[model samples]
Structures are given as structure tokens and as C-alpha cells.
Target: MRRHLRKLRSTPAVVLLFLILLFLLPYDNSFSPRAAIVSAVPALFEKRWWLINKPGAYPVDFSQDVAVLVKSGIGTKERIPSWLQAHEHMELSDLLLIGDFATLPGQEYQYRDQRLPVHDVLAWMIGRGYMAEDLDHPRLQKYYNLTRAIDREDVGAAQEMSGSFGWELDAMKFLSGMELLYSRFPDKKWYIMADDDTYLIQPSFKRLIEHFNPNREQYLGNPVGGEDCRFGHGGSSIILSHRAVSHLTSDREYLATAYRESLDETWGDKRLAVALNRLEIYIYEEYAAFFNGERPRTSKITKERLCTPVLSFHGLSSSSDMLSVSRTFEHATEQVLWIDLWNIPTSDKSDNAHLPKASTSLFDDPIYDTGHANWDYVGRPDEWTQSVEDVSSVETCKQICREERPDFCLAWTWDSNEKKCHMSWWIIKGDQAEGRTSGLNVPVVKGLVRSCRP
Candidate 1:
């Protein structure tokens, strides 16, 4: 099971609305009339928020406000206009980023300004001065030294790497970057290696790092495995904890030997995997779920119903796609807050929700199969499930149910002792079964449903 979702972290506007509701709403039975007025206040505010900030209401058009604001260097209350402003001042300097860049100016320099600040923040592992005829240039020597330091003598060729040469150059970049970054920032807690095409959501990445222990030797990223070794996908992103970096750097000669062996590999990720395998370290796979590239394993349909927050989306080639995804994520976060805080119903949010809510179907049996084995739904929890704490009041469960399809949310159970709320499409029978689960079918919420649709 996933850790409890941090849905309570909401936008400032939602927080203000909650504060007003908590204090201004009458809590006493003595003030019955006032209480009735207070109850209506939430509904009114919900509509107001929906009308102003609904997903469809604010289209992702960068030409409108984003361009104006970005050009003027005016950031919203939550975000900084410039990439460096948001991170350069942060205390988490212990983390290092190593990004690979190609020699071509057409692709590399074209999007330099538009490139996300995530790459500029850390040490970029690239051969900047290799284009010059003189190999003895200080910059070229630095590049040469970096390649040698990483133990990949096959990579630091004096000539520019073009066409098919990219493969070997990329592998050299990865090994060189790891060695250089470790040598530069030996005490750093985490290191992220990514390609120039990769886009990262830095804030969410920080949250991921904060949630885990960096002292241990762990690797996090999208898992791409060959027959022999499984490594974090470099294109998507690869995260190495301090211990992992330390382990790799602990033996200089051994690292050099491994690097030499991996020089023949086409893919840098595969080469890294080989090194990790030889080192007897396993890669942790959860980060891959969060850090997606061109192919997203998780679909849009299931992502909403589940309470987990998506950390990043990779493989965005164009600047527009990058900006769009970034804004979409921000907007989705706000929509979730409105849904949870205002108890907005999930009406036609997905095909699953649109297909008969099980309430209106006359012939369809609304009741769930009562007698099933323990854990009737035994698969892993996806984005379609929600687990809240202390949903003892049916009202609370009904509120969360509105965020999903009425038919899909078959039942909900609340454990008083644990104060855990487990919602499922599956419903079980019996008075206190193996688990402290309880609740009615989706039909019970038909009258209570609130539509988010226009």
C-alpha cells in the first residue's frame, strides 16, 4: 500500500476558504438558523471556486498570460519567473545534477533560453570546447580531464562527436559525469543524471528526495532492464543517493576497470546497470512510476481517482509541451483540492464515470457481491483508489466518492482504531469480517452526488 496522500496541502485560496468555513460556520445546536446559513455557505463558495478555476475554464494557452509574465520576469505567488531564482537560493545544495549535451548548435542552442532551469542548476557533463582545433585549450583540458577521471579514455576524442559518434560520447558523458560529480561534491546526498531532452519537475523531485533516506545506497528512476542487468533509464532520469555515489567512488581503480568494460556498450543506462550489477547493488523501481518519459505507464483515467501525486513527466521535446504539461499539473493539483475540499462529484470525468453510474440502470444489479475471499480486489492500488483516515461518518466517504465514478466506488470502510478510510469498487458482506471494513453500495450516493460537469 502507498503512504497516505498529502492532499491537505492545498493552494492559498483553498486554505483561506477552509479557514473561513471553520471559523465563520456556526458549530452550536443553539444557533440552528445560523448553522443552516453556514451549511449553505460551503455550496456557494464551491460554485464560485469552480466557475473561476475549473480545468476547462482555464485553457493551457501560453500566448495569453505565461508569455507576458515570463517576458516581464513576473512570477506568480507560488512560482518564480526565472529558473535560477527558485533554486539557486535553496539550501538543498547537497544535490547535484549531471546533464548530457550534444555538440550541435541547431538543437542545443535553439532551446537554450526555453530549456528548463532544472539542467542549468547543476554540473553539466558536456564537452564545451571540443570544437576548437587546439586540444590544449583550458576548457578542452577540463573536458579531457573529466573523461579521464570517469575512466573512459575511449570517449574524450579530440575531434567533435557527430552522427553515430553520439552513442560512445553519451556513454562517456555518463561515466565522466558520475566520477566528476562525486569528486566535486563528495558530500552531496543525491545526484541526478539526465539527457538534454529530458524535462524535470524540480519541486516534486525535491519532495521525493525529502521523503526517502539518502544515507543508504539506493538508485531511483525509470527501470529499463536488458536480459542481464536492470538500470535506471538515463533518458527518463537516474537518481543516485550519497551512499551509492560513495560506493562507486570508494575504489578508484575498480571504478576505472568497470568503466573500461562498459565503454563498448551503446546505451549509457545499460553500462551503468552493468557497473551496479558488478557492485552488487539493486535499483529501486518506484521512482520510474513518477518519472515518466515518452511512454507513460500510467494512464490519465486512473491517475485522478488515486490520491498519489505525479512527480514528473519526461520526453517533452518542444517548449510548448513542456510549458503545457507544467501548467496542466499545477491546474490538476488545484482541481483536486477543489474536489476534495468542496466535495465536488466526478460526473463524466472519464468513460468509466460516463457509462451508467449504476444508480439509473433498472436491470443492472447495483448490489456488490457480498461473499468473496479476503481482499476481493487483490491487485496493486492504482490511481483509481483512495485511502483517507477516519471516514467514520458516511458523509466523509460520500464526499470522497464524488471524486470518482459513483458506480466505480462500490463501498467504503472506516477503521475507528486506525482511523483509516479504505474506498473500493468491491464491497464485502458480513458484520465485522476479517477487517474493520464497512459501507453500502454506490447506489447510496446517487442522491448525494454533485456534478462537476458543466
Candidate 2:
């Protein structure tokens, strides 16, 4: 019995020895569980860190932006909804749809073989509360009478375009469609219009217009036509409140003339702008970031500049591209870093693009030149615009904007005292503050300029 007791006592020591060898010692001939565990420890922590910091996982921080809004209601004592409450108000059913489709039913988009932008858009729209009667070029008789893909004829044009290029037929179709849609669905609170090539992030779009009352006469879109005549870039899509649509329908003669004049215009977007302008329905600059002009897989600038949840992108030609964009932004992937209506980058910059150099100014370039003679000074300092710390000079700022953001850098601002420069890919004239040195990307500014009554 004593010997048995001694063996039991010794067993504990033996097990402890085995565990120590198993965990602490490394073996050359085979895999080391101990080493694996040690390496995995760091990896486990890394994965946990990533989960905690995941984008869109938490509510957005809009303390500063909200404060700005509160300041506007100084004496009135208006109640301000929390950001969460504002987001909750934007439901899918709140939107009324008007999509622009070519009379030709199914054309394969630019990138993929089987994927069709029209069919894809239609399929998603079917059960999503959008009515068939509401769409532009609604299937009156089913053009080909072919239901399935296997039944259709050969694929036609890669993309359906309007205005000029002898595509006047398509442009006229849009004008007529708009007139009919508004006539039928005139009472809907909000009308969202987009071409087949457009794909909307519904949640993002809802968040954008939640603050605006549907009863108000608000026209929201990316502002084009420079400082004079601003309109939304229709390719990116536009939202019209009931109040704005009323202006279109209230007078029959004006509507008739607008439609007739639009038939001859080179760009359908311009034609639409002219009609709206006649009604004095000005475009609101706040929603400009929602209009992304860049094609998918092109650049990150379009995503960063809006500084809001991305609402819609214009150049998603392929179904695959649309799917990717939808999935990518389904969860807020990035936080809106800035809240200025304009003067934000389209997308965030690469993680390691430019770092602050020093506290000293690198170049003595005038804080304000006669301006980039070619460029218009799109006001600044850009909203929530971060200063590039080590850039040192205006030349470096200009060079960085030119090389790094060829597609996105529309305008930039420099602060000589702080030895910093900031680049803005998007701009809002309303956000323009005085005494700030600024420059513009002239070519881009010129492209968006439309002849407006000065």
C-alpha cells in the first residue's frame, strides 16, 4: 500500500514533466506544437484587433457635423435628431423609382458576357417596391416578346448612349418618359432617376436624403455647370422632391416647350437641366459626393471624396461591377472622414501615399497666384480637409495632386504659415470661406461648365 501511494505521488511529477517537454521544447524532426501555439498567439490578437476595428461595425461619429447643424438653429430651438435616428428614418419604401432604360431590352454590358445591366437592375427592382409603370421605357409590349435569355436575339450595342451621335431617338425617349412618369406618379414623395448603367446603394442613398423633407422643393445631385448654371450629372442620377416635380407639371405650355427643346439638345443631361432651371429648381450641393463619375475598379478617389456613405456610381457598366460595388459598400467599409458638402476627396488615399515632411515650407510659391490661369479657384479651405504635414511647399502640393491623384485632384489649398497643403477632389462653392488660398483643376472645371444666365 505504501509503495502504491509512492507511485501515485510520482505520477503527478511525471505528467508535469511531460507537459513541460511538450510545450517548451522544440523538435527538428517534426512540427513543434509549442512553436505553433506561440506564433498563433500573436495572430489571434491580430484577428481580434481587426474585428474590433472593422469598418461600419460602429455608428459614425458626426459630433462636429451635427454641432454645425445645431448652430444654424440658434434662436428657433429646433430639435435635432441623433445620427442614429436620422439613419433609421431612411427606409427602402420611402423612395419612388424612375430608371432610364434603352428601348432595346437586353444588351450585354461592357465587361461581362452574360451579365446585363438592364436585366440585373430590373430583377433587383421587381420585389423592391418600385412599380413597372414608374420606370422609363417601361415594357409596353415586351420589345422582343422573349422572356428568357436563351430566347433573345444577338447582343446589340455594348452601352446605350443619348444626345448627339445620331442617338436623338434615345434622348427623346427619355424626355417623353419623364413627362409620362411625373404625370402618372406625381404625388410620390421623392422620385429617384437613374440610367441602366447606374447602381444605387439604397441605404447610402436613403441616408443622404433623410435630412431633407420630401414636401420641400429640393433638387439634389452632383453640381455641374460651374458657378453659373448648376445641374446634377444625370448619369450619376438625380433625386426630385414632390415640390420640384410640381413645377414641371403645374404648367402645360412650359412642359411642352421644355420637351420640344430637349429633343434637339446634344446632351440629355443638359436638356433636363434647362427644363428644371426654367422652373427655378436649383441643384442642392450637399449630395454631390453621392455622384461618382469613375468607372468601377478604376480608382479609390470617387469613394473617398464624397465623405458620405457612397450613394450611387455612374460608370458601372457590367453586372459584375454593379454586384461588386453593392457588396463592397453593403457594410460601411469606410467612415465618412469629412462632412463638408463639397471640397472632399472622392475616395480615401492609399495608406502610405504622402507623409508630412517637416514644419518648414519647401517652396515660396505665392499662397495665391493670379490662380492657375487655366484653373478656376473652386473655393477652399476644403471641408474637414486634412493638411499634408511634411509637404513643405505649394509645388510639392501641386506635384502630389498631379502625380498621385491625376483623376481626382480637382483643386487644392495651401497654408504658408502652417507649411501645409490640402487637396480637394470635389468642391462646393457654398462651402467657400474667405481669406483661404486656393487653386482649381481648370480642365475639370471647364468640362462641367454649362452656359447659364449670369
Candidate 3:
């Protein structure tokens, strides 16, 4: 009986010893020590932490409050699948896809298994006599020709005409879509209008709008153009509170005036702003940084933007780029700030490894191999430029960047043709230039990153 009691006591000790050994052992594909620990003590690591680690397992759904509208055309219709794939995890309440083509009223198209309601701006215009019976009307000629070209399925003619007349169609689409959205979902608190390429960071966007009153008229986005004609850059994602949309759509006279202006305007976004300006609803310039006009890889990670939560990224070149960005932030438990983008792994092979956390490291190393050949960091207004004696090579340009005060030089680009080296105070991932090379001051960037608020 005493021996049996001793065995029972020893069992608990043996089990404890086994657990200790298991935790200390190196992890493999089948098991992770960190995950094991998390599983063992569920109370210590909260649900938020667990969800952060397991991406796509627990998605934040904001379907009740907001509706997203994607503005696209037949030319870009193929991109819709990728766009849908990117936002698959975001449980949006209503996603309406609008274009310039004609569709029967209440028609829906099945794409990638989702039955999406289609809004045809062209059809709406025809029904409303905007593309009137008297096709000879000076303003209606272009619309008439474009409609004829589309009807005949003349791909070449349609493409050519669309290049010139598409802006007008797009403006009409935005106005009509707004009205339709209000009619379909008048209860929605907010509506977002974005291009097919634009990627909205749902969590950050939700966080931003939550602070504002949906009942108030709000027009918000990344403002562009002059103050007189300032409008939200459409590709950057334009946001409208329910009241704002109501005001724009409810006023028929305002809509007519806006449509007339659209015929003369070259861009739809500008026309939308012009229409709203008459109603005293201007773009909320304060939150401009939240609506980025650049893609993740090319976005400028300046000091001013480090702590700001990113709401959307515009001008993503491909669907793959969108998917990659979606994967990068899929598991984020908190709002994704601009600073967070800097640590994104360069490639899939380094998926588990983050770039060394940005910190104030004193070591000044001009990472030579990091220079991108045939690429240039475009000069900003605040950037410094100097003529380099050794125009034939990029070495001197790199040395100049390294020698400058860390605060003054975050990145440098050398132009072979101009024989000039430009150093920017902020880090801007620029575009390709045939005869240029660009590199970064790593240590200075680390310091800049460290300066941002958590």
C-alpha cells in the first residue's frame, strides 16, 4: 500500500520532468515551443495575442457600419478577382462594384463564387437622358459616340475613345453610385470609394472613422491639387459619412451642376470634390497621411508618418503585390503604423525573420550592395543635391551620403546622366530610372525608426 502511494507521487514528478524537457527541446515543423507554452497557459496569453499569431483565424469584421465601393471599368474588370482575394478576410457589410458598362437594373454578376451587384453608370446616364435622345447636343456627342462604340464591341475604338471620354463616365459613375448606395443601404454609417487597385487597411480605417460622428457630413481623404480645386486623390480611397452622401445625392441641382462640370473636367476625383465644395464639404486634410497614394514597397517611410496608422495604399502595380501586402499585415493585432512597414521581410524565405528592429545604432555603414541599379529615389522639395566630380561611378555619390550628418541624409540617389547626387532627409522608395542608382543610410534610418512612438 505504501509502495502504491509512492508510485502515484512519482507519476506527477515524472510528468513535470517530461514537460520541462519538451519545452527546452528545439522546435520542429510539428511543434513550436512558444506555441506549446501559449497552449499550456491560455490565461497568460490573451485571445488577442493568439489571434495575432494565427492570422486569418480571427478576422475583424466591420460589415455593419461601413460599405466599400470599388470603381472599375471593363478594361480593369480582370483585376476584380485579385481585389476580392485581398479583402476576403475583411468581412465588409456591402461591397458594390461599379463601372461604365451597361447592366440590367438589379443584375448581379458571379465572379469567383461571389454574387456581386453590378452598377452600370452608362445605363443610368441613358435612362436619365444624360446621354439624351437628342444625341446631337454638343456635350452629348462624345457620350453618344462612346456608347455606340461600346455597343458594337469595337475594342480598339472603345479603348481609344475611353482614354479621352472615360473621365466623364467615371464622374457620372461616382455620382450615380453614391445615390444607389444610399438607396440600397441608407442605414450604413459610412461609405468608402476607392479604385480597384486601392487596398484599405480595414482595422486602421475602422479605428479612424470610429472617432468621428457618422451623423455629421464628413469628406475625408489624401488631398491633392490646389486649395481651390483640392479633392481627395481617388486612388488613395475617399471616405464619406452618411450625411455627406445624403447631401450630395439629395440635391438634384447640385448633381446637375456637377455633371455639367464633369463634361469639361479631365478627372473624376476632382469633379467629386468640386461638387462637394459647393455643399461646403471639403476634404479633411488633417488625416491625409492615413490615405497613402503609394504602394507598400514604394511608400515613403518618413519620420512624420512613422507613428501614423495607415488606412489605405494606392497604386499597387499587380494583384500579387496586393496579396503580399495583405499577408504581411493579416495577423496584426493593433493598427498598422507606417513604421511597421519597414520591418516587412524582403522575401518569402525570410518570412519568419523581421528586419533588425530600427534603433539608434551609432555604426555608420554605407551598405553598397543594397544600392538598386537603374533605380532612382525621386527628388523631393526638401532634398539636397550636389554635383559629384566622379560622374562615371556611384561610389562618390554613396560616400557623400555616408559623410552627411545622419539627420540630413536618410537616402541618396545618383544620376549618371545629370552627374548629380541627391540626398533626401526622408526615405522614399522611388521608381525606376534608367541611368540612376540609389542606396540608403541604414544607421540613420534605424534612428528615424526608433524615434517614432510605439
Candidate 4:
């Protein structure tokens, strides 16, 4: 009996020990569990960071370029709405769209006027800081009345508010636009923002912009001076610069914290202007020049300078006629050998082969490569834009272009800044052996290669 009891006690001890060993043992699941984990890692290896402009990603090896983006809301009718109404869809251009802000609650704005540079109306909102007491001001009531006057129909507040809302919102859009634009083209030097209501006749604006202290990180529209700048209004229409706009819109919280109270208080012109200006941080008071410059007419400084210190702002209060003028210019757009990608002539390409040459493998080359686009073994990037491998047969190339929806694309010179495909159609030939030095008269679809603007 003594031996039996001892054995039973020993059995309990042994079972406890077994449990501890089992717990300590690294148990895994299925097939040699350790081998399964190793194999699983092979599948995980396929995922990787994607980089554009990498030698292994694009056909041509280069980076950097500029982009011109427009901002407008089709609150109403169609001026030339297919791609962009800002420049009227002219060809040979660099244009991007900054969505129309909440133009109209219902998408239909008071469409009777395209000639008014409504931007001028914003002047009334400038200056001033929101205060706690102004909540009872009678002018606030009037401004709200004005907002209601601007738009009629159901939904959202009519112009019951003053320009403060618009100004703040514009600042938001401007800042957001800059962040997004930079993200797309990490190396671009500047961003030019334009409006749809004006007549920007300065074709050399970019060159002039570059000429001005290319090293200076920011610029003003057209510099002007006025002792009364604080109490006075100045500036031509153009407001140029590259600084972040956060400083201008960051302080709306004091009044903005309570919409019901603040909206009712921002009425009187003087007080309202003070509150708004407090939020607008101008890089330079150069705005005064845009409004009070020596030349009232459009200034043409030798392709490099504006004859007048200030550029003209013709589209205020009346832009319809000017818009018509722009349309007339569009008619003159001619297609003269500008499709660079469509194999110009060998002589032309050799003249400007500044770009690095890239070799191509047939779509399926089979010779240690990830897989050829044609020859499943040649190792060029699958994402890179195609560079010409052989141009001996020009007619065959043309045939291919025609068969593929007759789209003629401008040759893209890789931009290191933006690190994406960029084509400068605004100034280039299309039919040359290599590329054109002029614009082309292609269908809107053909214009799809770049922006549909001249």
C-alpha cells in the first residue's frame, strides 16, 4: 500500500513536469512549421515601395518641370468647359484644374455676368479683426443682407455673410493646392495660380517670373507703393508668390469658433475689414502697385519687363469682351509639326538628344529580367515611358499612331522635380523628324496627351 501511494504521488509530479515541458516546447502548425514560415516569407517579399522616376521605372532618365494649374467653379453655363475654361482650352499649354469652390449650392450660379472680376468685391472684406462686441453691429445685418442678394433659390446661406467667409476659404484652397502640387512634383520650383475671370495676355509670364531673382523663394503680383495702403486699396490684378498661405487664414478661430455669433457680428465695413486683414498676411504690400501703377493699360516690358510696373487687370466688372478676344486668339492656333513623340526626323532628334538614351526589349523578351515588355527577358522598367528603339521606319510609326485613335502626343522629357512624364507642347514642333517647334490643330481627344490648351 505504501509503495502504491508513493507511486501515485510520483505520477502527479511527473504529469506536472510533462505539462511544463509541453508549454515550453515551441509548437507550430502543419508541415514542418518552421519550413512553412520560411516559405511564407517568399510570398511576402513581392511587396515593395514604389518609386517613380527611378531608372528601373521609366524609359527615359530625367526629372523636373513646371505645371500651370487653374482654379474656377462652373457655378453656371459652359464657356469652354470640356477641359478648362480658365485658358479656353488652347493647345500647347501646361494647365491644371483647382476645382471650383462651392460656387453655388445647387451648381447654378447667377450666370448673367462673365465679365465682372468679382474678385474685386473681396476688397470690402479685407482689413479688420473679429471682435467680441461687434456681434451687435448693424452693418453685420447689412452684409448678411448683401449675401442673400447675391444668390437666390433654396439651400445654403445666400450672401448673408460678408467677404470673410470667401477670403478664409480661398486661403484654405490655396494652401491645400500647394501641398498637393508639390507632392506630385517634388522638385518643381514654383506654382502659378490664375483665375478664370481675367485676361492673362502675358505669354512670357513664366520667363519673366524666372528672371525675377530666380533664387528668391517668393514674389508679389506687381509691386506698388501707397502710404494709404492700410486705409487705401492698391494692386493690379495679378498676385504672384510662392510662400505658404497658412499665415493668412490661420486665425479664423476667434470669430469662427461660433458661426451664429460671428456671422452676425461681421457687418460694418471698417470693423469687418480690420478683422479680415488681421488674418491676411501679405508677403509684400506690392499689391498697391497692381492697383495704382503708372500704366493703366496692359504693360509690355521688353519680353523681360512689364512696360508699366504693374500688369493690366482688364477683366474687372467687365470680362465678356476680353474673353471674346481670347477666343479670337484661339482660332489662330495652327498645327505645325509639334508632335515630338511621333518620331520627327533622325536629323532633328540628333540635334537635341540631350536626354539620355534608353534601350528597349520587345514586350516579351525572354532573356534573367523580370520579364520583357515583349522580349520577356530584357530588364528595363515596365512603368517607364517608351523611348524610341528604332525609327528607321517612320511611316510604320505614323500608322501605329493613327490606328491608336489618331492621338498625336508631344514627346515627354522626363522631369526630375515632378518625377512624372512631362511634355511641353506650348512651344514645340510636332511633325519634325524628332519634334515640332509649334502647336498643332488636333481634336480635343488628341490634345489629351497634355492639357487641352494653347
The runs of at least 3 residues in candidate 4 whose Cα sits more than 4 Å from the true structure, single-residue gaps closed, are: 1-86, 90-102, 105-134, 149-197, 212-217, 228-235, 244-312, 316-320, 328-454
Cα lDDT, model 2, residue 157: 23
lDDT of 3 by residue, 362-435 (tens): 22334433677887653443424434455556877777777754556667788888787777765654556788
Model 1: how far residue 54 lies from native, Å: 28
TM-score to true structure, per model: 0.42, 0.43, 0.73, 0.32
Candidate 2 local lDDT, 131-182, one digit each (tens): 3433343242232121232234322321221111223333433444444446
Superposed Cα deviation of residue 320, candidate 1 (Å): 3.1
Name the better of 1 and 2 by lDDT: 2
Count backbone overlaps in model 3: 1
Best by lDDT: 3
**Ordering by lDDT:** 3, 2, 1, 4
- Show the colliding residue pairs in model 1: 306-383, 390-419
The lDDT values for all models are 0.43, 0.44, 0.68, 0.31
Task: Summarize candidate 4's per-residue lDDT along 44-92 as a digit string, tens digits.
Answer: 3222111111222112111133444444432321332422432443331
lDDT at position 44, candidate 1:
39
TM-score for candidate 3, please give it: 0.73
**Model 1 lDDT tens row, 134-253:** 424433344444434334434334223322243444554565567666676665666776554444544345545544456666677777876577787776677776777778767766
